[model samples]
Each structure stands twice: as C-alpha cells, then as structure tokens.
Target chain A: MTATTLETDLAGLVAQASEGAVTPAQALAEPHSLGLLGLTSLGFLRLIHAVERRYGVALDLDDDVSYLDTIGSLAAHLRERGV
Target chain B: MPTVAVRGAPGAAAPLTWGQYAIWAAIGRTAPNDHYFNLTRVLTPPDRCRPLDPDTALDRIGTALSRHPALRTRIVPAGTAPGRAPAGTDRSAVPPGSAVQQEIVAEADVAVRTVAAADEATAGSAATDLVEELAATAFDYGTEAPVRVGLVLVDGAVARVVLALCHLATDGHGADILLRDLRLALLGRTGPPPGDPGTVVAEETSAAGRDRSDGVVDTWRDAYRALPPSMFPTPRAEPQPVRWWVGRLTSPALGLAAAALAARHRTSVSSVLLAATAAMVSADGAGDRAAVLTIVGNRFDPSRRDLVATLSQEGLFTLDTSAADFADLLRPAWRESLRAYRSGYYDQLALDAALAQVSAERGEQVHPMCCFNDMRLVDLPPGPAPTAEQVRAARAATVFTWAAPQPLVGCRFCAHVTAAGPALTYQVTGDTRYLPPQRLRAFALGLEELVVAAVAGPAPLAALPARLGGAAA
Candidate 1:
C-alpha cells in the first residue's frame, strides 16, 4: 500500500478503536499523542487488536514504545517491520 | 439456617469457560480458605420500594437465580454428569484434575438464614455478622450452588439481604450486575436476560478462542522474559509468626489528590494510583523498572458486559520508574495498563505452560507476584483540583490500621484500591518477611502521602524514599 493509503487505513482503525471519540481526520492529522487525542485505555487496547488483525503483527508495548508517541511514528515503525 | 428451594431454567453441561478455569485454579490453590474468593454484598431495598416479607424475598431470590444461570450453576469433575455424581462418592473430595465442567441445575436449594431484629440498627448488626459467617464458609463446588443468602428482618419485615457468592460464579463486576438484577426482581420487574454461560464455554473453546488464548500466552511469554523474575526477590526482614500482614489506609486526601492528578494527566484514576505504586515499589529498591500483576476486569466485550461469571484476571504491568518527575510516569502507566488489560484474557493452562517455558529458559520462576487491584466499579471523576491546604486538612482524618494477619496469602505484595465513603482506601497485604508490620504501615501511608504531595506540585521521584521514611529503601 502507498503511504497515504496506509495512513488512511490506520486512521480508520484508530477511529474505530476510539469508538468515534477521535475522528479519522483527527487521527490522520497526527495530534500530540493518542492519549492526548482522547483515546481511552480500552480504546488503545482495541487499536492494538485492530492493528494486529490488519497487519498480522502483534504490537509489543513492553518493547521500545516510542512508536506509540504519535501516529506518524507508529506508522513509520510498522513500515520498518515490513507492513 | 433455613433452606429455600429455588428452581431455574436448566442449562446444558459444558466445559468451564476460560474465566471460570482461572478462578477454579485459584480456588484450588487457596484450598480450605477458598472462601477468600467469596464475594459478599449486603443490599437493602430503597425507601421508594415497599418492604419485603419473607415470601417476597424468597420469590425475588428465585427470580434472580432464574435470570442469571451462573447463580444456580454447580461445578463437578470433568466427566461427571450434573446430578449423577457416582452414587455415594464424595463429590466435594473430588480433585479438580486437569479440567472441570459446570452444569446449571433446574432446581437447587439455597441456604437462607434469617435474623430478626427490633430496629434497623439491630438489623444492620445482625446482617453484618451473618455476612461474615456466610463469607467465611467455603463453597462445596461439586454439591452446592454458588450462592448463600441471608435475610435480616427488621420488625418482621425483610430489611436487608446478604449474599455470599462464590468467585467461581461471579467476579466483582458480575456481582454488581447480580445485585442490580436482584434489586429489580425485588421490585417486581425484570431486567435483560444475562448472557448464557454455555455460550461462553462454546465461544471460549472455538477456533477463535484458541487463537486469542495463544496470543495472550505469547504476550505473557514476552512479558515474563522482559520483567524481573520476582518483584520481591530478597527478604528484608524475618517472617513474623503470622507470615503475612495486611495494612489498610483510608485517606480522603489521597482520593482528592488522585482525582486531581488523573484529571491533569488526562488518564484514569487507576493509572495515577498505579504510577504512584510503581514509584513506591521502585523506591523500595525492587528495581528501576517495576512490574505488577494488575487485576483486569475482562468485560470490554459488549456481549460479556452483563455476564454474571468470573471474567476478571491478572495482567502484567511493567513501568519504568526512573523518571525525574512522578507526573512523567502517568502517561506510560496508562498505556502499559491498557496493554496489561488486553493480555488478561487467555487460557490459564496455556499461560502456565508459557510461564513454565520462560522460567525454564531463565533458570528461575518468572512471576511478578506483586499485585494491584482497583475494585471501584466506577472511578470518581476528576472534580476541581483540591488546594494543598485543603488536602493537608483532609489528611487529619486519615486512618492507618493493621488488619488480621493471615497464615497464607497468594502474593508477597497485594495492593487494592477502593472507595470508602468520601475517602479512598488502600489496602496492602504483604509477606511479613518482605514487609514487616511497620513497613506495611509505611507502604499504605506512603501511598496516601505521595499522592497528596503530588497535588501541590510535581513530586520528585528521588525524594520518594525519604518521603516513605526509608521503608522502601
């Protein structure tokens, strides 16, 4: 997938995970951080599940979680993992 | 104790669900004191509702049992049929073996003990004693239903209802749901039908279930590898005669400060409290990174929201407490807490296998053992941040007391947070060898002081040991 398409797909998952609390546009905009963008603890778990389901790659937060700082960083990490 | 016969819609026999298996394993580990897992609740009808007579109370209890199949469910050895426990064989003596199955009975008798009191105060006292008696009694999983009911009659009217529920039947959240349904039943109303336990069993054993369980085990393996073998590896003091001690701290200031911090950090109150606990554990010289097994209520799924079953499980939460300011830990704590909660739902057997594998690899057991449970059903929302003076004044009402020591406990450090009226109560039950009675008091009080101090400004992590009076150091 192209960069834009990948981000758009991720944004859709983020929106769904947030239970519509954070819009797809807001997610794509790359706000301060997911936590600041109003993604709840349960929403974050749902996002992890959604990402794992979509990418077939489990997200390990115990590892270096700097990727979780923002959407752009998360997208970059996924790309490095051959997403 | 008078027996009340209750008949409900019977459910088919099925293998225990993943959640049930987890609690069942704990029950076995706990053994004779398996009653430790009993959840007790004393409920009274609201003033708006009419007083209940003995017959009406019995009818309500029956309605509740019929609505929630879990209340009438009984567990037996894997292959044994519901009512056909091999004739004359002692069902209670049956070992859990590798698996146990649960069967819902159409007719089961519940022990209903009644206490008559002259007034509400007398009734309350009688209810408390009855609740303690019922709660301390272990449930015979094979032969008895999962619930014991007690009614306290004030002037011949049922004024209070006490229920001692087996943890195998329901968790804290599930218990709340049961209480709500029971209240509705008392008012001659019916709530939505609860989720079927058999469906839970089927879903848990399906292909999707296996995959989910596998994923959770994989997560556990990775976490076990990353975390220290044990949070309390070295004993700081000799074990007391009792071996385990419990300390409880009730602080209105801690509640106020925690709410303020949670609001400021834009996270849940649980995360704020967890961050402080990680800080304290780290200060106690455990390590720069603190790992705690946080109890997770696995009720995120909409379908399982109202399911009166044991779905709560522990999730591993590892946090780096090497930050300069305590506030810096809240965001990461929240994030890792979410991860832990996600990892809580899995096959307990598979999780054990994974732990064994990791322990073998590491040449030691890989269990954090330290636990944190926030038992509040709904967190107190962040109100206006309390001023430092306000928090300090509220601190005068803080109470720290040592509870009865236990001969056996499940963990070295088991911390729980619950709302107590206008205060937040923190209870820590620790192995006496690791946390002496004095240190236990310090730990509980330290939690309150740390949170209350943070309300004024950013609390320095380096100053934590001194603030805790070097109890952690």
Candidate 2:
C-alpha cells in the first residue's frame, strides 16, 4: 500500500477508535499518541487487527510503543514493513 | 450510636445465588481482609445550589435503601429452620442442605457517618480511608446489614458520598444501580421501583436443573485439570500474605482497538482484552499456558438484569500461549471465553469440592494466578456528544487521575479494567514482593504493547528477557 493509502486507513481506524473525537484530517495533520486522541487499549488492538487484515501484514512488534505514538510514525513503520 | 437491626422486606427472602455462596465461602475461610468487597465514591458540588443538610441527606439515603432490596438484606445460613440461629460461623458447621439465604429488611436504620473536611480532596481522602477500614473489618452475615454509607462534608456542605458493599450483597453493576437511584432520589425524583427479585429467583431456580447436569460440571473439571498451576511469575515459595501495589494504565487507543477487534470477531470487547491478557502473560514467560479466573457478570438472565444483587462469579478460562503466532490464538480465546461464561453459575460448595478433587488428582493446587474484571459495560450515563467548543474546552482542561489506595485479596495479582469516556483505565493491584513493582509495571506496559503487536501483524511475538523459572533478572 502507498503511504497515502496507509495514512487514510490508519486515520479511519483512529477516528473509529476515538468515537469521532479525532478526525482523519486531524490524525494525519499531527504526531501524537492515538491514546491522546481517545483510542482505548481495546480500540488500538482492533486497529492493529484491522490494519493487518487490510494490508495482509502481521505486526509482530510486541513490547514496543514508539511506532504507535502517532499516525505519521505508524504509517512510516508500516511503509518499512511494506504494508 | 450503635447500629439498629431490622427484618428483611416481606416477600423478598430468597436463597443466595451460587456466585454469592462462593464468595461467602472464601470469606469464611480466609483472613479478615480476604473478603471480596467494593467501594464507590461520588462527589457532587451541592444540591439545588445549596448545602445539603443532614436530614435531607438521611432522607435521600433512606429512600435509596427502601428501593433496593439487596441493600437492605441480611444473610441467613441455609437449613436452620425458619427464625432459628444461622448454623454457626464455621463452614463445616453448616449442613449439606444449608444454602445461604437472603432476608430483605422492610425498614432499617441507615448508618451515616458524617466527616468534616476542609475541601473536596480532603473529604474524598477521608471517605477512602474509611472504606479501607471498613473493608478490613469482616461483615456479620448472620445479623448486620451488608451495606454501609459514609457522607463527607466540605465546609459544612455535603460533598462526597461513599457506598461500600460486601460482594455477598451486590456486584459492581448492582452498586451502580443503587448509586444511580440514589442520585435520582437526591434530586427529588422518584427512581424506578425496585427490580423484581421474586421473578429472578424463580427463573434461576427453574434453570438450576439444567445447570446441575453432569456434562456441564465435567467440562469445567476437565478444563481445570488442563490448566497450568499458576500463570504468573512469583518468587518461588508458598503464597505469602496478600499485599497490594496498585497502578493505572490509561489510554484511549486501547478502547477503540478492542472495540474494533470485538466487532470483527463478533464477540464482546471483554473477550478481546482477556485474550490479550493471556498472550501478554505468556509472552512475559509467566507461563506457556495461561489459566485466568475471569469475573463474569451473570446478568445474561434478562429477568435479573436490573436487579440489585450479587450476580457476578469467577469462571476459569485457560489458553495455550505456545502458539508462535498471536493471531492464531484469538479464535480459540474467544471460544474459551464463551465456554467459561456458560459454566459460570454452578454451586460454589460443590464446585470447590470438585476443585479439591482435581487438585488432589493433579498432585498440586490448581488455581489461576491472575484475575481479570471488566467494568466497561457498567457505564454511567454518557455526556452529550461533544461540540467543537466543548471538545476544545475538554482539551484545555487539566487532566488528572486520583486513585485511592486499595487492598488486594484472594490471589497474588488482580487487574480491574474500566472505561472512562473513550479511554480505558486499568486498576492493577498485587503483592509487590511476589511481583516486584518494577516488573509488574513492566508487565502492564507489555500488556499494552502486546495488543499493539497482536494487531500490528503476524510477526513473531517477543519473548520477555527472563523466564520465571530462570535466574532472577
């Protein structure tokens, strides 16, 4: 997936997780923890599952939180994984 | 003043459900601090823009007590013949036919302790201290009321109300119902009538036959035998006296992620979190096989859904974390959660006897190392959907979380997860000696990361630095 597509999908998941507290445009415009945007632990897990299913990439990154801090970084990481 | 005793409400007397009996049994066997109890705190500015007077406060509490039968009920030990003394304090003193009973009081004197504090914070702290003190003191199920209330005054105005209940009287959900109704009564509104316990008891009694079938008990027995002895890493020794180190993990991301996964899997968000917990514990090398005691809110019976009573029970769920891939385990985790819920409401005494039998056969005690309670479903009324201005205001407001010092019980570790708005808050308490503070905090962080990775993709799960059986890290 292209960076744009990855960002779009990540934004949708973030918005869904946040219950529309943060929008797709807002999520892509900045770098912050999705946690700050109201994405719950369960919601984040679901987002991971959604991203994996969409790109067919399995994220084995346990015990790590740096990549999940922001949408930009998450997209960058997914790009590195060739999602 | 001394507490005033009263009789139960007419027509509300009934047998204790299996769940209550299990907790009652545990309380009877354990130390003074071992009982399963809940403390709730509500802070309000004032009533109708004026200070809440003592009489008004009593009136509100009295109205609430009158509405909820569970709040006014006392435990009557089984099979002592009506109006006779309950079979003694010891478990063995009670005979086989002696089931726990609930006798609701038609009217009773409410114990309202008035504490004077300088401010809201001090008031809340005082109330919390009282809750801790009350929790350590065992309840006299044979005579005294199972519920108590504390009112804190700030600058001569009622500001904080704390309601503490023994798990025998009500579960968290029931407590919430009581509080909601109490709030309404305080506002001078008549809340809904007490939920029909008579109908609930009848339905449960009817279903008791199917619940006793051999197939159900045998399935649970097999599951218990298959479970790992303990799925948590503790210093190798007999379990020590319970001590608690509580911490909170707040994240909005986790709530949404779990919701999405739950939707995709067609399961509840709780199942998703539990699966994640099992995976996290296993990945940390707590155990290759995860055996957890999950608290199931047995409100699935529609008739009892709104009743204020103890409808929560602990159900065992075991999982194999040996899978190299985390995604491969979600389906099985969800399935096992269903099985656990289905077999949740069996007789506590019979189940304990069966567990002892299984433990003997296995040549070791088989108890879950961890306990998980999901309180997300017991939500308060939601605030109106946020407008842009409201969202900005919320963002601008300083965010702070204050957690009361809580005591731990039953097991070495217990994790209670609740939702605050879109964010998820985890209240974890455990014995720090067994689970060192640093390591426990690390495990909590790992749980968060594990969920991130579980959905991140099919990457190999990371192994913790040190296994429990290996040398101390």
- Native-contact recovery for every candidate? 0.21, 0.00
Docking class of 2: incorrect
Candidate 2: lDDT of B151? 71
Model 2, residue A79: distance off in Å is: 44
Model 1 steric clash pairs = none
Model 2 lDDT per residue over B114-216, tens place: 6778886677778777665555565666665677777777777777676677777788878877777777767777766667755655655675444653445
For residues A18-65, what per-residue lDDT tens digits would candidate 1 score against the true structure? 667788898888555665566655566667777887899978776556
The 10-residue segment with the lowest total lDDT in model 2 chain B: B378-387
Alpha carbon lDDT at A16, candidate 1: 83
Q: What tens digits encode model 1's per-residue C-alpha lDDT throughout B1-473?
A: 67767677787778777778888887777676677778998888766565777887787778776678788787766787656654334545455433677788787788798888889878788888899989887787877888999999887888998999989889999999999888888888888868876777777789999998898889788878988788766677889998889889988888878876766666667878888888888877778889998888887665777799888888888898989988888878877887778878898888988899999999988777799999985553423555678788898999988887777777889998889986888999999898778877887787787788887887888887775556454
Tens digit of lDDT per residue, candidate 2, span A18-41? 556668887787554454444544
C-alpha root-mean-square deviation, each candidate: 4.4, 10.9
Chain A TM-score values for every predicted structure, listed in order: 0.91, 0.81
